[model samples]
Target: MLQGDSSAEGTQPPDIEWVFCESIVDAFPLLEEEDVAGIWMSRTSLPQTSEIRGMMQSGLMLRDMPEGVALLDADLRVIWANHRLLQWAGRPSGTPLGMTFYELLHNPEIMGPDFCPFHTALATGDESSSTLHSMDNQYFQVHAAPVRSAESPRNLIVTVGEITDEILQQQKLAAIHQAGRELADLRPNEIFMMEVDDRIDLLKDNIQHYLSDLLNFEVIEIRVLEQTTGDLIPLLSVGIDEEASDRRLSAHPRENGITGYVAASGVSYVCHDVQNDPLFIPGVADARSSLTVPLVLHDQVLGTINVESPDVAAFSDSDLQFLEIFARDIAFALNTLELLVAQKANTAQQSCDAIHSAVALPVDAILNDAVHVMEGYIGHSPEVMDRLRRILQNSRDIKRTI
Candidate 1:
């Protein structure tokens, strides 16, 4: 076979595909060095451009006047631009034809600062939605559709639309109103509404006043409801007067009252009273007025925020309203932080359980062995009996748990 594969071009190898080759020995008998490459090419007939155009026209037609549509190449270079998008860009349809995204806009600031959704989607392969684009000097929302073919997945088509002017104006007005409320939060009463849902290890205290002072409480604090326990624990309070400041009241909160209510109900509680309110614990001094807000995310209560001041009726309706908004925002931020904390805790707990389980048996076995070993020496001492009794009792308790 190897002899037959020889030719003037050097060697013409046997067609190994005609027989099964299981190893280099089998291949060596059927193939030669010059026959390593076996290649052939042939021409095929294809339809002309006119026929392709007719096929395209027969298949589909634009049914609606969507705001804008564009096509892009594998490199995300704009290949074609529809009239609507050209108008949005303040240019003729063919103007952006040869230009890349960076060249077309003269600024490559992510999907948004200017080009937005399209830029964002291409960069992240993640869908983005924006109801308004403020950079074009004309308000509009844009969407991108990436067109990919089974044969070539990198090709793309992006379709964008300009939402009506009326909707854009409404969005702008809403922004202004929201900004006005955000601006009124002048106090450093930063409220960290965290979870009380079977997750807390330590409690917060004058930490609120300390934080308010730190964050400017004239702005924020972690709130807690002053409660023993029950429903409607609408308040989460934190903020310290000179007394509550000096005393970490919640180090171990005795149940039943406003603080407890906040923990139990997970509702944002507001009370202008600090010392005399039904939520305030008796014998606790220097607290004046208070506001307790729940830290909630995904309809679940994490914990409550309590803000307190030494002055009588310190919190006003504006304070209550603005703080509630802040509380809602804070809840989201806290939830993010909680994910990290919970992950770390779970890891540490797994480690601790592993260590405890490993050590518990060895420790008990060693203690028992020590008692047996001492029986011949220290066992004679009268005091050893009492010591062994105490150790044995403790060991029994430890063993029961393990």
Candidate 2:
């Protein structure tokens, strides 16, 4: 170690120096729109999106708002919204007059049509999103109720968001301030966040037990959806209990129930009670409640997210939506990890489209070729070959294309 001045002799090493400064995620403390809208909601501290300058010049109006409301109208126009809604909408400086809400999103073409809440209200008379997106990289929580007026029965009284960048930034500041405590909680929980890479690696550096303890659950399992089976096979599990630690679960593609169902089906579920619920798996359904959320990247389910609780009916629709948001975060990291791993192998992901007709090669030959191509796959010993042959036979038996 380099000798420091005598005054610095007792200072800790840089590795242990600790990051006291705020990071972006921590820079903004996060709040959900739903939180401040409860029965006991405050009557003040609400700012309409239109009131915020630069966001509503295009004849856009923020109206029909409650003290703490946030909402938009059809055509994705910014009608009346809150500061918190502003954050969820990701509107910079409250003035996004010229820009459409969908314009801020990466896949507006698809998410936009679904964001047609006005149409939903007209149809159902009441509507709320189990999930939503304000922009390409951001998510939001939304609530809408029919606002009946003599003029228009289909009018809506929508209270939008309880989250904003300012709130997030404040949260970030608070998190930075609480770094010392957060560091303590980081133990035991192996937190891994997916960034712009493909290779999967553990977020081993920040395992402070204190953070893990505060996380409510001891373990979090992240499994990738195998394209072949549509199963949420283990890519990683953090703070696993004695029962499931260091173990890999078999992935079910297309056919695997629950885990497979969610991954392949892209459905989000909130298990208010796992042990008592019919959908809960038999043995592992010990938790009071659990959430099975889909991890999607580029509109494809890359994996499933599992969060548990000891209280029955523990998971809520809001919680499930939050898990989905987290899943997207995980998906981003996972995609990066996959890209990194694929890059190391210098090979493209094998698409099984041509199994039957490619080059007139017999299915058996194709099986051998695939077995060879898969990086971690073992040799074509009699047992393994027998398995591959059986799979091919099974497919042929059902007339299923590989």
RMSD of each: 25.4, 29.6
Candidate 1 global Cα RMSD = 25.4
TM-score (C-alpha) between model 2 and the true structure: 0.35
| Alpha-carbon deviation at 331 in model 2, angstroms | 0.8
Clashes of each: 54, 43
CA displacement after TM-score superposition, residue 263 of candidate 2 (Å) = 1.3
State the lDDT at 328 in candidate 2: 64
| Model 1: CA > 4 A from native | 1-255, 282-284, 344-402
Model 2 per-residue lDDT tens digits across residues 1-402: 111213333464554332221222221122233332211111231232223243444224443233235344444454555554454445544655533434433333323334665567768877644235434434344456666544346455555443445444444445433543333332212322233231133432232232244234454666676687543567555544645433434344333435655765678767675655565553243456677778788898787767666677766654554455545655665565555555534432343444335533565566556456443445546666667666656645544544
lDDT of 1 by residue, 114-212 (tens): 446555666666555554443554545545655544544554566665655656445544543454344333222232333344222222222333335
Candidate 1 shows a clash count of: 54
